[model samples]
Target: MKLLRNILFTSTLLMSAFAAGTAANADPGRFMDMKKSVKAPIGHKQFCQDNGWACPRESYDPVVVQLNEELWQQLIAVNAEVNRRVKPMTDNDLFGKEEHWSYPVNGYGDCEEYVLEKQRVLMEAGWPKSALLITVAKDVQNSGHAVLTVRTDHGDMILDNQIEAVLPWYSTPYRYIKRQSASSPVAWTGIADTRVTTVSSVSR
Candidate 1:
């Protein structure tokens, strides 16, 4: 059980680091605004077809979680634990397809899978379905990537598999693209990020 103890220690440390970065709830500018409705990602569409329960489409009022210390700690623990437990494997290698989104059944998945798992965990923990959003973005390399966006009264915080510490939407390096709408879990909305940046894909 040595490995289990080490994992617990690491999770605690992650939660502490996230709590230290806590900020008071701010104005509307801190929250990322939604634009026109957009189509859901292909992988997500197929994922919904297969796992409908995970993607709740029922209409409800948008929820912005009031970020309390307890919830903040929980988010950190969930984010870190999932990132640590799940090994990164691309869709093609794992499913023989270029793009596939599903839970990490074998403890392996790509970026979007991480997002899905985290969202699921939080929902199971009593977090609202409207608050946890599956977001798409262009990574630092300008490659397509996925991250979990958690809406809260403090702001729109991002829980990314690539990064351990939760970050505000604006603080992330990604050029915001689109995400599931807060009002409707299945509906998608565009992110009007007008920031211009130059990034080129790196060939290994």
Candidate 2:
């Protein structure tokens, strides 16, 4: 009887925690929208060639900024899945070379694959392609890194492999560089008008 009581108590606490998290998880009004500059990193073409990943031929209309409980739920679900499923690996370890970007065909892939998969899944799930962008940023080590940026009415929230939680762009630790333009997915665009020197990564 005592053990049963303990288990019930723990379950209650867990539910309470989840409720609090859901309530506090997404509050767009607290964040003011800001612009960040971007530039395409070198070797993208060669990287695409090496990995057999096709570059997007064209762009699409940006997803209308619609932020509600459902959109936020979708964002949270996708971000959590990608973060958990894709193992972190460098291009060198995975491909014996650098900048080898591709979608995750197997269970493991690099950072770029994480972004690609997230973009693909969200699109398949009926999210607008334009709102989903494969973004490259400079990490804490100044190394080039990739993430999927989801544009919404609240702001641009980052969906990253290194982090499980979806956060506003300004909350991340990396410096925003270049991202795929919503109007043209194949073409890159700058994140202009802002500088993000440090954004805290959820995990190392």
Best by lDDT: 1
Cα-based lDDT for every prediction: 0.79, 0.66
- Residue-wise C-alpha lDDT for candidate 2, range 8-106, written one tens digit per residue: 354345435444222222432322333443444554555555544345566566675577776777888988998788887777888787667777746
TM-scores vs. true structure, each candidate: 0.82, 0.71
Could you give candidate 1's per-residue lDDT for residues 58-122 as a string of tens digits?
88999889877778779889999999999999889999988888999699999988999999899
The number of residue pairs in model 1 that clash at the backbone is 0
Error of 1 at 202 (Å): 17
- Model 1 clash pairs are none
Q: Give residue 100's error in model 2 in angstroms.
A: 0.8
Residue 149 accuracy (lDDT) in model 1: 94
| Top TM-score hit | 1
* Candidate 1 wrongly placed segments (more than 4 Å): 1-28, 197-204
